[model samples]
Target: MIDQLFLNNFKAFRSASIRLAPVTLLTGLNSSGKSTVLQSLALLRQSYDSGILMSIDGDTDSYGGFLLDGDLVELGTGQDLLHEDFASNPPGADPRISIAFTTTDKQQYGWTAQYVPEQDVLPLNLAIGPSDWRDAALFSRRFQYLQADRITPATTYPRSHHQAIGRGFLGARGEHAVNFLRHHAQDVVPEGHPLRHPEAGGHTLLDQVVAWMQELCPGVNLEASEIPGIDSVRLSFGFGGTAGLDSTRRRRPTNVGFGLTYALPIVVACLTAGPGSLILLENPEAHLHPRGQSRMASLIAAAASAGAQLIVETHSDHVLDGTRLAVKQGRLAAGDTAVHFFRGNGAGVEIITPTVAEDGSLSEWPEGFFDESENTLDQLLG
Candidate 1:
């Protein structure tokens, strides 16, 4: 859904503009500024959702304060957090982030945020510009960003309040995963019904998700329940095998495998997102096996086809392959997906754009790019 993104004096990007498709895949080696692009989009969307942007107040004791500290520190030190080459201009130069995107209905929107360094504090300013075109009304929704190290596996469970689990948005680290489910239980199912009714699209969404997960790991069924004394909800899994079926459910999230917990939010987002929504995901393939990773890619493509605009930063070749497969299967059109690879050089990082042809083949592939695993294997073998 996003049409374009522009960055100036931000992180490793001195000045760069990238065109976006319905499903945009950002792949690069470590420190190639892939996460920076997602972070910028997250901040932009956050600003819009919150309706105001403030400077990094050093005294606040919240996550926003920490984010402010991190952003300013990154800017002040001019160090590439991911080990890439990131430099600040001579002096007195302001850093700015600008994003231009179009909604599903074809309305265009642009937002620019600028930060000016001061003696001991930095002043942040935000500006909302007119979209180049207009169609439908645009609403601000929460931006989702999943870092590589922060993924929570699905095998974990959370505390619950009742037998019924609700549905809500999953937190970044999946901390509120169970609570999210419990809160949105109504959306998960219709009133006075145990099985999903035909008219309830949300039920169908969950069913599709379960069906897909079964393809990855056979005999796995997911259900939600609320804890007796807690306000949170927990997830339980039923396994089928030769020995009678067994079920293992936990109230604490720490018990499950990291992959399931981490991938759940992605699945939920894909199933729940509506038109004009923007989802920014970093390393959606983290902790997933090759097959699971490929399946995840297909899920993302399906979400985009359903009208959500997704920007994914990944290092998994399976993810790329999945996208290509989606194109080949006619689930996604060639023009609907864009793949950008970032390569670092003395001048900074340059981006290579790969086009998906009608036959689902890439127009070109960059050298020494997106082969982190292969490069490591070669070094070890040699």
Candidate 2:
């Protein structure tokens, strides 16, 4: 697990070092640098995926660099990433953008890239760590980065053998989720595992997925199958009329409410992610009702308890409260959870961390940190 993340001259941060835990929640207002935290990690993963982050003996500068645009992230160019008017830049040295991570094992991996205004590939100036950093969970196969703008209700989703099957990667937007589900449906979520949903019909991956989805919409079950002779996979939903809807019919994702499809990847990712997994989630609460939003947080907590390191970027108070509840219920240790609220300063970002106590209470609730409902209620009462 990543014990800490450090960014220098990265977007919205001139220099910031954030202590992380098994489950780290990044919560704050719009554009307050919450997403930047996730993006920094994604940036490294994408670079590694593109063969830019690896350590090679040759001209490592030409052989390795930060791939700004790739399968996981599209950061554009160096100008887009570097902090605007960053306070410190050496006079002669090519300005560098640095992103570093410290593992729970006390090992730190730091990468410095020479920022070039128009270059999409920021040439690597230095890589600090053991030679084989790929062994880290960040580059390991058990990793998922589900972007905020996930797939909408679609009739079919892509089935990529190399991505969904070979690599076990659910695409950045979770485009490969349906195909992944189809392939891994029968896989068992091991017994005594925190990810094994108790209410699931059986231990199969699909069963756990359905059981978890049911939390969003009760009695809801889903199936994923290959569309005959096509490279795409199909997703369909079945309801048990719990909401007074038709129970007998199987409906495509489009026919159901938007929440189910949009949230599918999150459910699948959390359920299937085993120990040593690194999941970076952006806005898992999107499109979910308040209760569903909270339930997702509990699920996230469970995944973390199962030994997956999760860094979640959310704007939902329900998620925050649900995580607290998880701590109190003993699903997740309070010390293993870290909550950071980001706020915009003049040129960079400010981070305020609130400690979670064992009893589901926070050490401090800063103003504007999950206080919108009360703030609005105050306005209405006035």
lDDT of 1 by residue, 1-382 (tens): 5677777656778777887787899998888878778766655434434434432233233122112223112233223221233234435454444445544345455544444333222224433334322222122433355555563544335553232133233444545555554455445533433122233324544454455555455555556566576544556555552111134432333554666666766776676666665677878888778999998888888777767778899888999999999999998888999899997877888999989987889988778656667889999999
* TM values, all candidates: 0.74, 0.95
lDDT, model 1: 0.59
lDDT of 1 at 219: 58
- Candidate 2 stretches greater than 4 Å from native: 54-63, 87-92, 241-248
lDDT of each: 0.59, 0.88
Q: After superposition, how far is residue 85 of candidate 2 from its true place, in Å?
A: 2.2
Choose the strongest candidate by lDDT: 2
Our model 1 lands, by Cα RMSD against the true structure, at: 7.1
Looking at model 1, report the run of 10 residues with the lowest lDDT sum: 63-72
